[model samples]
Target: MAYKARLQEFSDTLDAEVIDLKKLRKLVFNGCPDSGYRSKCWKLLLSYLPRERKHWKTELEKQRNTYMQFIDEMIIKPGREATEHGGLADVTLDDHPLNPNPDSEWRAYFKDNEMLLQIDKDCRRLCPDFNFFQCASKHPCSRLCGKNSFETLRKRVEQTVLQSESVSRNRLGITNMSAVKRKSSSEFVPLPDGQEAHWEVCERILFVFAKLNTGLGYIQGMNEILGPIYYTFATDPDTECEEFAEADSFFCFTTLMSEIRDNFIKTLDDSQCGIGGLMDQLMSQLKEQDPTLWHKLQEQDLKPQFYAFRWLTLMLSQEFPLPDVIRIWDSLFSQEKCSTFLIKVACAMLLLLKDDLLRGDFPSNMKLVQNFPYSTFDVQKVLKKAVEISR
Candidate 1:
């Protein structure tokens, strides 16, 4: 069968208690290696099976404990004593302890490992779209919630959002206000009713992001990014076949989300170690290639962060067409090492518009910088050029 047909078949079979363990094994092995759970692939498969819910819950708890141990180990290096405890710790503690200020730590972490952390957060939040085990109480992941338990916090969020029908509907904009306003000249137009549909989309997106990035929780901007995905999937379920294909889309999205989460949730500190270094390299190259533009920006006291931050952060989601975004993402998944390729794409985009950039006025140049791909640059061409440049 063709790939889409096979995917549809799998979706149809989602409720089946008797899974083809062999096929399940293949899927897990194929997908889980890069996730640092290669050895735990079998465990993940077992945990997902219908009969294993109780055992899965227990195993998941054990996994959380293991995750906490790993974090503790990293924080207190070997041969060093933990400050809290007198005994030798597994890893060295930071010279400065994590402060109570949430934004400070988040900002610092994002600045350092921008790519890795964003991807890490995005992946965790969106995994297993319907039954998200990662962010639920089932998983005791300290990396996400810190001291506050994930389950308790998640339940509170659900209750707060779900309890008030009026709030949920208004928040989701389920009502056509313009249409309602057209019919009535009332000062306060009531919101249209469709609470269940609104909540379904909201919850699914929330669950996806929450499960994918346990550390970050649900930030405000996440909803905006996910809005399009939810709309595209759920708006016309009958026509889009989303109802029939929900399971497949869920799994496919889970796989895709795993690949790109780092781009979304990173703080400045988190990028310093990985793509952060690459960003520095790219900036240097840009300076060498376009010193005039580079110097112009410096003369204005404008840093690359002002313009290029979103590009690096969201993997061009805000800039490119959704179709183009999907294509680029497909390429990202195809390549084992995609970071360098992404940088090359960024370079290609800059190079493609070099002529227009050189001729434009300061304001125009700034505008071009602000709206990357500026007018006339082709995303597909740039992506293709990026692949070639990386090679």
Candidate 2:
């Protein structure tokens, strides 16, 4: 009965004409109700949606239509041109595949394919324990299948000859190489040519993001960050919201990325906001909260880079199951100082396993932190402990 009452309170809070974010955050910090509250709470928390309910429809339409325009300009037209021309020789005399010119469209397309391939590989393996990503979305992108549409990122990748090259590395320094080969459409088994899977939608979003943001063109773990946001919006109960899930997810993911992009940029790794600085903050917090454990870890030389790099960089998405990650994100997004609070949570995670770290050697501790024991501890407890640490 108390749970139902709290859920009702959350519903009432969200339904307010202009939401009080302070109040909303306090309610949402506990965790969103499973009955589709996250879809709205996340949008608001991420600032993708305005506080005022009256502006929602207009804002959504403008953004969704703009996203479709991006698709038409970036993906569909380029794809159609590539299809119509058949080859570089036919398309233009000046800019061929081998053109060394920086402005060459063909070069840009090939480069995008390289990034897209990496995004595809990471997205395909997303939450492998569940078939949610592999399963066909009930509301596949209709614009891509319309009379004017030419091809999607999935189709283009299968048909195009992607050059074999080393794309980029993750936080842990593992290099990813892409060697895409031409394959037939018939090879796409689970879904037919017109239909789309969840991961394909994610791939298109990341591809467009990479193209628009050339400076930080798609990183390896970006797909992991995007997966949960897309999944939350994609599974919304409201058909109208789910129909535009791709657009909604794209905007929300973009907003979230703006805040965390520094961590992914190589040049900024040691800067105040970069991953290195973040890990330093984590270690400092550990040293303050549990001096003995902090000294022990330092003596063993178990740097936060080995484990917390993935934990902090990926926002703990890779460490825990999808559901638990989402639950953790509920508290994270609600916090005013999300990143500062994240350090506190990291400290709490270590303090929770203080005994194990003290008893075990470096290898065991590395394995334990890398593969967090999510099953052993309640996520609620982790959040509560994080709160206590903050206090």
Candidate 3:
């Protein structure tokens, strides 16, 4: 489809209105009716249409099952082959060996392919980019919360959080790994009052991730990557409460993930094809904008991929504040040509930092490169520059 048409279609389907978690919760859980556009778009995007409003549950199940089958057939089998050439299989796992069964037929498959099913399993559980659980009940539940029972609590909390009027405006701030670890250890051990609800939202987010990209599988750090979105989706009027509105926020998030899955998958591929392409483009642009700096970087053998991998993989999730990340994601998903937009944004960042980067020595340059989005760089301005460059 033409980009404009695609954007229009998507906008029409999504109604181009900002979704509120409270309204979504009521629509999703309270048996509140959906507008025709919402119902139509939901079915169109999910590729499942129910004959009656009452049949949504059955339809959802069928959609989930169909999605799983598609992954098993189209993504997993093909991915296994594509990854066999020391591709995705080479990544080591800390937990367990790949395909422990020696005599099983899967072993033969693994030996020939040089693939690790265990890593695949880990990807299914951890990667926020791939949605592997759409067809199966493979998510880990807290042993403390009984199986699937937490879902009920989650729904209730979502409703309460969305409807309450006294919710705090304080955003969850980002702290360094050390600080987070110390705070986590010192925090009260008792499950927060809405712990189940929080986890429930996480579960749903995982489910959506699995459904969206079976090839990427689940990975660790995804929960952290998705934390702000979960909190935003569940934020309610009550200061202490968290709630989920219908599947609206979830689906909206699903759309955003769909837009960014390629960048996420690039992290897993040792080939770094996407990152390499971006690096090539960045180098070309750098040469044009600042030949001296570009030549210096080349002289030092400092490839863009060395430092920019995290920027591409996590969409700057680790480097930027959650609100800024969310803004970037919003622009990415809202725009029809997000992939190109992302490339341009990356270029803009490099260009904006060129002066500082050129002044630093190799080791210092590496450190400064690691600390991107430096004090002088404005993310929004960079984004605008990217959009223009992309155009």
Per-model C-alpha lDDT, please? 0.43, 0.81, 0.45
What's the best-to-worst order under TM-score?
A: 2, 3, 1
Better candidate number, 1 or 2, judged by TM-score: 2
The best candidate in terms of TM-score: 2
Relative to the true structure, candidate 1 reaches a TM of 0.45
Model 2 clash pairs?
none
TM-score of each: 0.45, 0.89, 0.50
Give model 2's clash tally: 0
Model 3 residue 308 distance off true place after TM-score fit, in angstroms: 1.0
By TM-score, the better pick of 2 and 3 is: 2
lDDT of 1 by residue, 248-277 (tens): 233334444455455454453247543355
Of the candidates numbered 1 and 3, which has the greater TM-score value?
3
**Top-lDDT structure, candidate number:** 2
Error of 2 at 372 (Å): 0.8
Candidate 3 lDDT trough over 10 residues, lowest sum: 170-179
**What is candidate 3's lDDT per residue for 273-389, written digit by digit as tens?**
554555565667768766887888898888776666666656666656655665565445333444555666676787777777778788988877777753567667777777666
Q: What's model 1's lDDT at 186?
A: 33
Q: Rank the candidates by lDDT, best first.
A: 2, 3, 1
